[model samples]
Target chain A: MLSIKNLHASVEGKEILKGINLEIKAGEVHAIMGPNGSGKSTLSQVLAGNDAFEVTSGSVTMNGENLLEKETEERARDGVFLAFQYPVEIPGVSNLQFMRTSVNAMRHHRGESEMNAAEFMKLAREVSKQVDLDPAFLKRGVNEGFSGGEKKRNEIMQALMLQPKLAILDETDSGLDIDALKVVSDGVNALRAEDRAILMVTHYQRLLDHIVPDFVHVLADGKIVKSGGRELALELEDRGYAWLGIKDDETAANSAN
Target chain B: MTTANKEVNELIKREYEHGFVTDIEVDTFEPGLSEDVITRLSEIKKEPQFMLEWRLKAYRRWLEMEEPDWAHLGYDRIDYNSVSYYSAPKRKEDMPQSLDEVDPELLKTYEKLGIPLHEHAKLAGVAVDAVFDSVSVATTFKEPLAKAGVIFCSISEAVRDYPELVQKYLGTVVPHTDNFFAGLNAAVFSDGTFVYVPKGVRCPMELSTYFRINAANTGQFERTLIIADEGSYVSYLEGCTAPMRDENQLHAAVVELVALDNAEIKYSTVQNWYPGDENGKGGIYNFVTKRAACIGKNSKVSWTQVETGSAITWKYPSCILRGEGSVGEFYSVALTHNHQQADTGTKMIHLGKNTTSTIISKGISAGKSSNVYRGLVKFGPRAEGARNFTECDSLLIGDQCGAHTFPYIESLNKSAIVEHEATTSKVSDEQMFLCRQRGIDMERAVSMIVNGFCKDVFKELPMEFAVEAGKLLEVSLEGSVG
Candidate 1:
């Protein structure tokens, strides 16, 4: 459902993603695990077409359409969703209004009729229940004064509402307790469609234990150095990243030994 | 990215829609100001002798007063002598008894401004008094209002027909000697709306006035007065728009409202004067003075305004709560864009025991414009058990714009309670990116956030006006995003 060829990216004159090549087919779930500063987040941002990060040399295609040539909003309309690592807080815009505008924009792009307020509210309530988010939070400002877990659930609710073809989850498990982690996993598992693809990016193996992936790729120094099955996450967790001979700036190799 | 910013800029650079001029024969005075000019103005209006004396008194007082410079604004010195004191569309010597007798071109001008003078027009529930340039051309629904024992007419007509009521309330709340602009407005004010709700009578419909500046080089000085008698209630709306011009025009208006025992008055304004070009070349300089007085026990007054235009705006709508247990409210939203500058707010004075007041102000600044909020709350010695609450919030859209707050509070009553809150925020980069990532464009996102910030003030406006106010904010903030 998604394809990337030799993705090279940078931010403010500093290279971040050296060369990222990945491919995922329909109905498969892929997880990319890496240590800090390993370009896991950069890949998600690049796929979403964030203006802060420039693709120095690369091409991304979603559903056979050139995604990199589209604007940020156009890419979202084209069914590419990126759940942000740190969602922004907009003080004045309500979450319901935000969701309605997004849903209508996508529907308009697909030559479908816009959803009425009643239907929109009904869909919002139904999907929010799946993510364990209270309906009261929908009337509040977008992510304003929200806790980390609530924000993650809200992101998932948005993804469920849009029903994107490709969804990239960036650090969705961070700052969540065991209960929230379980709820988030349940929501993702419910959205497992035969024609959709999910790419999970995380630094730890804890999230994989709930929403296990079919294939695991270890990203080191901006490239996929190893590929294996779900067991690769357990191996990386038992033996720290130093066992892979990758020395970070901190060089905390001895502590792991 | 540069191309996207260019598209955003184009979206913001919308042209002023009501810039067309009407072709009609006009009666205008020469460019100058003098006692003889005021005498001629009163004589032309066929005012009572007392009215002539009042104008002369105001003219004498104005000559001795200097223009106040305390407001934070920059502009070339105004040439009072270079402005025509009066301009009116030529018509029958007598006032038009109905819309049919009014000049067709003048009626067409008002129609172009979205105000229909015919009684059976689309604006169903409201009665409008259309003021063109320097004189009132036509006032609709006067007969129905007269049937309700409500007196609604032009100030000039009231001077001739109901001299006693006009004499009793005129300038009582806002005296001519109040300030520089008030003095000038009193000296040369031509015509505006006058409304009076009789004792125990509720006005049947909303009363409104639409002021338009059409003649070139003419200064519009409007005088408005409304009085709600005992056990009465009324809602009055004021709206204004001017034609585009290269040279800056002057608009100095004075509005005074009075509420008597157990009476209530709600006054709202939507001001859309010509706010010069994007480069700040020429526009209207709007300096207005508006105040309300609660003169009897249990009286109430509220002021809701949306100010969006004018190159340099200096205004303060205030309230004097002099009646025991009286209430006052002020809700305002002021926006400045493309080199516009505005310094506006309200003043609340508690003079009687248990008087209460609430003030909510929202200011938005975009482009290179500057928006300032200056408010004052005072509690007199006899204002025992009085209370005041104030909230001032500002939103900035671009780096080149500016927002400022100046609040002054003074209390002499030991038992009085006063509270103030202020906050400043911006359209953060993170917020913009989040909206864009959610499939919304830059302009729509900025406008939505701005309208949300101003929701409190917008809710205070009348239902139809609230919608217009929201659209006005969106149009004014165009070209402000990247």
Candidate 2:
């Protein structure tokens, strides 16, 4: 469903994602574990088409369609979702209104009829329950004055509503409490399907316990040093990436191979 | 229109929108300042002698005064003599008694401007006073307003019939010498709506004035004076729009409000004067002076405005809290798109003890436009226990546009509490992505986000105006984001 070939990326003239190569099929959960500044967030931003980051080399494709050429919104309509590490606070925009607009926009882009107010409210109600979000909060401004946990949960709820083909959760569990993490994971787990893929980016191995990954790739200094099963997260958790002794360039070569 | 046609038409249209007129039919006089024009305008209105003398005094004071340049705006020197002192729609010797008697073409023009005066005449609820150029075309609900002892009519008629009321309140809140435009409006304003809510009476319906500019190369100078007597309440709405022209038309208007002890006045404006075209050609230069005074104890006055037009808009509808425990509020949403420029905000002067004021301003700039929020909150020495809260936010749609907030806070009383908050930001791609990821397309996302950014001020508007404002923002920022 997704392919990245020698994905070299930089932000503000500094190289971050150094020749990253990855392949994922549908219905699979992939976890990318990296140390601080290992380009974990940068990779997510680059994939989501953040203008700040420049892709210096390589190509990315989703379902055989070139992704880099598409605008951020176009990429999103084509079924790509990125859960931000820090959710933006839009003061005057209500969460529910934002959700409805997004859902209808995506539907419109797919050449489908737009949803009426009643239909949108119905979907919002259902999704709110799935993410354990209170309906009242939906009427509040988008992420304005929201707690960290609420922001993460709202992102999950949005993802659940959009039902994207590829869901990239970047540090979704970073600031969430145990309860919020559980709710978010449950929402993500419910979204798992045969034709969908999940890319979980995290520093801690704890999230892996909730949403177990089929493939765990350890990223260090902008490259993936090792790739293994769920046990790899446990190994990295027990003994940090120092034991690997693999620099970022070596990891890129290994992943390319 | 197709994009190509729009482009071609826009070029031809641009020249006319901003071109200077040379041979337009205009009634003019000599360049120097004088009381003669004031007397002539009053005589044309057939106003009483006292009103004529009032104008004479104001005109004399205006000559001694200097044009105000303190406002955060810039413009070339105005050729005062070149401007006509009065330019009314040619009316029959006899006044029109009904809608059918009025000029059908003029009525059609009003209809095209979205003000259905004929229907309003038939409707029982809404009352409208259609002011064209420099004269009142027709006033609806005259009898109904008269039944309540509420004198709602043209300022000219008020000078003739309700002389005492007009004399008691005119220029009391905002003196003629207050500013250059105010003095000019006081001197040469041909005619405008005059509303008087009697003491202890609640106005039965919303009072509205629709101002239109039709004659070529003529400035529209209208004066609006609304007085809500003690224990009275009234809501007055004003809307303005002009025909497409190439040369920059001048529209300098003055609106004054007086809220007596325990009285409340709410004034709202939706100004859509012809904004110059995309390349900043031909549109109205709207320089207006609107101010209100809370004179009696516990009196309240509020100003709400939605400015979405004009080539250069310079207006600051303000309030003066003179009575103890009086309240003043200003809520504004100014949008400048496609080469428009606006410098507007409000001022609240707290002079009485325990007075309070609140100001919320939201400015959106797109397409090389510039929007500014310049406000002042002042607390006098006797204004003990005064409090004020102000919030100004700007949303920049494109990098080429600019938004600025200049708030002046002065407190002479040590017990006063004043707080102000302002922020400027561009719509971020990341934020748009988050919305799109939720299924919102980029345009919808932009609209939703921008609306949210202005939700704080929108909530302050009346229900109907709030909805209209939301939709207006959407239309104003169309094609702003990709």
Candidate 3:
């Protein structure tokens, strides 16, 4: 239920995503793998309505609604979720307060009454257990002084709490330990269902082994160069991006013209 | 602009909520200052001979005192001669003997500000001395307080009824020569609350005073004195508000407290005067002096204030720890927005052995306002084994606002220990983006964050007042986020 056509984006007057096209129907999981400078994170941020990235020429639609025209918060209420690679720390706002406010916002948009504190607390405890986080973290400031692995798991916990229709996981496994990776993957696996789509952006194939994807695409110089089935990931894992005839960083990216 | 910023911009434009004027006839003196004016004021109140003599003496001292300008403030020179000294509601009879006798319009004015003066209301149980303009029209829970051996009434009444107590303690802590503002307040002060807790008695209920300035071109000078006799304990609260006007009105108030042997006193204030318009056209210039003296051994005193308004504020509530093993504490939360400027803090003077003090100050500045924290902690040679701890934190919201800290510390005894810490922070854009991404409204996010920053100070306020203080900060911060 998501479509991106010839999406071109830039930051600070320098182009990043150039004429990339992708479409995914419901109940499908798509993984886009690329090198360090292939604009993998930039693509996710642009879709999340980050104003820093200038969407020069393209169109994005979620269920036929113009996604680019909506503000960041409106997109969030419209079931769009982005798991940040580096979670921001709000030193004084408790994690429980932050999550409850977000969940209530989504429920309000769906014409449902806000949940009371007691009811919200029960749901939050269950989600925290699923992500292997201690209940005590709820009382602490949001992501304040959290370990790298805990922050990644907190992002997964938030995603599970929001239950978005279009979940964009941007390098969720970058900083997780092996055990935390297992817990986070289980949470993501539980999110799969009918009428929902998932997009995973990553640089490693290790995450692919946990929650296998239906489709894999190789992104290089802001363009999806190759598309294949699940086995393509294992092939690319054996031979690096150079074997795919794509330079990682020093390519200048002039080919976008 | 993004939708989050756009929504906040609208809220930032909200006008001050308590800006309406009360329509009533008033007896106002012409705008000027002289010995004749002070004499007329004392005569109108029909004070005792000693009281009139005291006012004349203070007026002479005020004349000799050049208006002090050493504060960290920038403002036009105040024309003292151009300000009317006395303005009170026109009354043809004696003071109101009961709620039924008070003018309905005056009661309505208090009602519009969410302060119910009727005895049946729950708030009336707190014993409020409602000071309007330059005179006190009503005081609550007088009989119950009197039964408890607590003398609670207006200062004017105290001078006439409890002359011995008034003569014993008035001006003893902060004398007429204390400072410029205190000198002015002592000379031409109109009316304020006077509270006395008898020996070995705890006040039956919290005492509060609400000061309202409704007349135009009149400066409000309030003088308050609270005495806790030996082995007594009491808590007093003061709140002030004024109507919106284009001419800069002046508010000069002096508050003094005295604690006897083993006695304790707690004072709290929430000052929300008009802070002028966005371009700084008109508001109140609040210059107040408040102090307490712990003269008896083991006495304690604490000051808590939440100041959120005023075009320009200059106040420093202080404590003199003269009793052995006495304790002093100060907690403050000052927020300034629009064109407001505030320079407020506290002072702790240790003169006896084993005296201790603690200070926690939080200043929040938004829009084009400026907030400053100026504090002093001094230990004399007799203060052996004394200690003091201080913490100051500032949070800046917009790019144009400013925050400053000036802490003066002095110690004569080698055994004295002083610890001070200061920090400055901002509401970063990334933090805003994070909250906005969660679909929380802009106003809610800012208020929540600011409330968290001020949680430490709000807890020190009384139970009901803590809630009001939080809401006041939210209202004050409105339209400050653009």
Clash pairs detected, candidate 1: B12-B478, B12-B479
Best model per TM-score = 1
TM-score winner between 1 and 2, please give it. Answer: 1
Ranking by TM-score: 1, 3, 2
- List the RMSD of every prediction in angstroms: 2.5, 5.3, 3.5
In model 1, the Cα lDDT at residue A64 comes to: 88
Sort candidate 3 into its docking category: acceptable
lDDT of 2 at B454: 74
Can you give the lDDT of residue B225 in candidate 2?
A: 95
Interface RMSD of every candidate?
A: 2.5, 5.7, 2.6
Off by over 4 Å in 2: A247-257, B1-40, B120-124, B337-340, B366-370, B397-404, B439-442
Q: After superposition, how far is residue A200 of candidate 3 from its true place, in Å?
A: 2.8
Writing each residue's lDDT as its tens digit, candidate 1 over B220-312 gives 999999999999999999998888899999999999999999999999999999999888977899999999999989899999999999999
Candidate 1 regions exceeding 4 Å error are: A247-257, B1-11
Q: Model 3, stretches more than 4 Å misplaced? A: A246-257, B1-11
Candidate 1 chain B weakest lDDT stretch, 10 residues = B2-11
